[model samples]
Target: MKIAIYTLGCKVNQYETQAMEQELSRRGHEIVSFSGAADAYVVNTCSVTAVSDQKSRQMLSRARREHPGAVVAVCGCYPQTRPEDVRKLDVDLIAGTGDRMGFLDLLEQELEDRRPMEAVDRVFDRRAFEILPAGGLEGRTRAMLKVEDGCVNFCSYCIIPYARGPVRSLPPEEAAARAKELAAAGYQEMVLTGIEISSWGGDLKTGQSLIDLMELLSDAAPGLRLRLGSLEPRTIDGDFCRRAAKLPNLCPQFHLSMQSGCDETLKRMNRKYDTARYFRSVALLKEYFDRPAVTTDMIVGFPGETEEEFAQSLDFIRRCGFARMHIFPYSIRPGTPAAELAQIPAAVKESRAARAAAVADEMRKEYLEGCVGQVYPVLFEQAKGDRFSGHAPNYTEVLVPGSENLHNRVLATRITGTEGFSLLGELEETP
Candidate 1:
């Protein structure tokens, strides 16, 4: 069987698609390009914003139209959140966010029986973390290991809490074993990713925190560089910083979720922390790690956000000095609480997004320039022309002219300059 997977939004979805691809390939299936012909088409979807939902619908519809007889399988956050929308589509198999192995079984069953099937369950009732196969089919240098699942935050603007259910975490032993396997498989880095990683250990009876899991992973795979996904600001404390700082294999990049910088806006958005608390997390990372890259996400023109509040947010983000930022103009999801509030005009939202993007672009350039003359251990992943490009411990892209076979090797690189969005550097000769 030939399978084509079309994934949309977030690293967790990508990780899930990769896991499914691996399992399907192991079962004697040929994975083909999404644009090419295939007997099965899997559309892993997202529902973070209105735009994502639209894209999900478009992809599902296109898959069905392109291959009239192919099995159209829809999965992920979109179907988990709004199965009714998916039911209207011409899909053969529908699986929600959880239960990847079960989804595969259903897919194979449908192939054998040629029956339309739906396996989506009530995501809110899920208690245990559904562990999937780790490592990606494409990359040898880096792999995303989903250690946590579900979010309970329930922010006013977010529908993910309902889509993903309560916090469920992979046990420390399981995470450690996966990391060791990835390291043994020649992966240089493994990212600890999930829906809400900071909320890890909340549903567990063991009372161990994310810090404990990090410690275990570092110990189990001493040779692999462990990296974190997006984190809640309040999760970082003095103890976590101290312990995480001691882990030599951990990357020094922190991505704190700062949706809105204005306190009033944060209150409206139901965020757990204020600007002061978020700044503290930023300060702690800088204090503990050596020149760590701090990145974040922000939503502009949220519900009931005033011009003054937006200005304050712009000012606040400049103060935080983020190395990179994902700036989103707020979009209304029909079921979310924020969608019912007084909405901002589309023109205003887009204008604010542009302004915020300009500020973020400058900060990104400054951060890249700051990398000049610094020496870093870059794990090369791909090549462009005669040069191989990879990422440093801080997750900054560093490109250097080298042999083509730099894949999966950690070479010392000294930063020289910047070209376009990438940092240009050269390989360091070690005596």
Candidate 2:
């Protein structure tokens, strides 16, 4: 069978898609491009926001139109929360956030019998973690290993907790083994991703934290560059930074989640940390790692966010000087606590987002300026025209003129200039 997978949402979704693709390949199925016709089309969906849900439906409709007779299987957070919504779209197979291996089996059986199947379980009742393969079939430069699942944070604006259930973790030994396997598979970099990596060891009583897992993975795959996904600001501390900085393979880039910089807005959003603690985390990371790229996500214009509050947020972000930021206008997601609050006007939200984005753009330019003339070790991933593009250890994109075979090799490149969001560099002679 020829299978095509359309992934939506976060890094965890991407990791799961890779694992499903690997499973299908091992079962004698051929993976094909989503643009082409296939025997089966899997739409791995997301419900992070209303826009994400709309996009997932759009992909499903396109798949159905493109492959009239093919089986359309839908899975992930969207279906986990609203299985009936996905079933209404005429999909043949519908599964939720849990039991991905079982989902694949049901999909295969439906393909053989030419029948429909719906196997969504109660997300809150889920207890065991679904372990999937960690790498992609393509000789990709970076792979993602999901060591944890689910979230208990229950942030007022987030619907992930309801869709993903309670926390579950992959045992430390299993995570270390997957890291070794990914490295042996020729992936130059690995990103440890999850719904909430900070809650990694809470399910187990082994006294292991994310820092402990980092040490194990560093020893398991000493040659591979290891990067982390978005982290809660509350997880960063002197102890966490001290242990993590000693791992030679760990990337210097850290993305601390900061939905709002103002204490009042953070309180409304039910964030765990205040501005002072968040700033402390940022300061500690910079003090430990030389010029490490610290980035974050921000939501502008929450309900009842006054001009003074917004200004405070803008001022705080300027002080932090993030290398990059994902600025989002507040979206009202139904069933969340924020949706029940006094809604902010769309025009106000748009204006605040624009202002925040401008400030972020200025800070990004300054951060890139600081990287000028510095030589970095970059792993080339692809070639375009006369240049091969790759990413540095800090996850900054770098483009340089080189041969195609430089795909997975790390090379020393001297920063020359800037090209949009990427850095332009010249390849230095190998020692």
Candidate 3:
């Protein structure tokens, strides 16, 4: 059988799609591009926002229209939360956000029986972590290893808690094993991803945490660089930084989730931490790591966000001196508490987003300029034009003129200049 996968949303969704593809290939099926016709088309959907939901539906509609006879399967957050809405699209196989292996089996069964199959279960009822394969199809230098699942932080604007259920962790030994497997598979780096990786070990009685899992995996695969997915700001205290800094393989790029920088806006958003605690996390990372790339996400226009609050957020972000930031104008997601609250006009949201984006651009340029004249080890991934582009230990994209064979190999490069968000460099001679 030939299979095609169309993935939408975050790194976790991408990781799951890759795992499913690998599983199908292991079962004697050939994987093809989503644009190409196939025996089955898997649409791993996302419903993070109203916009994300619309995009998911658009992809599903296009997939069915393009490949009329192929078995269409939908899974992930969207179907997990609103299975009935997905069923209306007339997909052949529908499974929610659990038991991916079982979902594959059910997909095959539906194809065999030539009948529609709905395998979605109440997402809140899921308690066990579903272990999927790690790594990607291409021989890329980086891969993702999902060590945890689900989230307990029911932020007012998020539906992920309902769609993904409570925190369920992959045991430390299993996480270590998976990291080793990825290393053996020739992956040079692995990103530890999950819905809420900071909440890892909440369900465990052994008192293990994300730091424990990182320690285990760092030892399990010493050759592989370990990167983390979006992390809760509360997870980066002095203790966590001290232990993580000891791991030679851990990447220094930390993306702390800060939806809003203003304390008042954060309170309205129901975020767990205040601006002070979030700034402390940023300070601790810089204190422990050598010029680590501290990145963050910010929501520009929350409900009842006054001009004063917006200005406070802008100033707060500028004060943090973030290397990069993802700025979003608040989109009213239906079924979320924030959606029913006082709404901001589209023009106001757009203006705030634009203002935040300008500040983000300035910060990015400043960070890139700081990289100039520094020699860093870059893991080259691919060649483009007269240069081979890759990333440094801080996850900053570096482009340097090098041989095609440099792909998948780490090379020391002296930063020459900066072009927007990317760094231009040249290969440095060995000592």
Give the range where candidate 3 is weakest over 10 consecutive residues by summed lDDT: 400-409
How much does candidate 2 score in TM-score? 0.97
What are the Cα lDDT values of the candidates?
0.91, 0.91, 0.90
lDDT of 2 by residue, 1-431 (tens): 99999999998999899899999899999999999979999999999998989999999999999789999989999998877788789799989888888998999998999888888888889888888989876878898899999999999999999889999999999999999898888989889899999899889888888899999999999989999999998789999999999999999999999989899999999999999999999999999898999999999989989999999999999999999999999998877999999988999999999999999999998888788799999999888887888899888899887565578989999999997778999888562
Candidate 3 residue-wise lDDT at 331: 89
Error of 1 at 187 (Å): 0.3
What tens-digit string does per-residue lDDT give for candidate 1 at 151-214? 8888999999878888999988889889989988888899999999997888888888999999
lDDT of 1 at 369: 90
Task: Report the Cα RMSD per candidate.
Answer: 1.3, 1.3, 1.3
- Candidate 3 regions exceeding 4 Å error are 429-431
Q: Count the backbone clashes (under 3 Å) in each candidate.
A: 0, 0, 0
Give the lDDT of residue 391 in candidate 1.
Answer: 94
lDDT tens per residue, model 3, 199-270: 888898798888988898999999999999999999999999999999998999999999988898898888
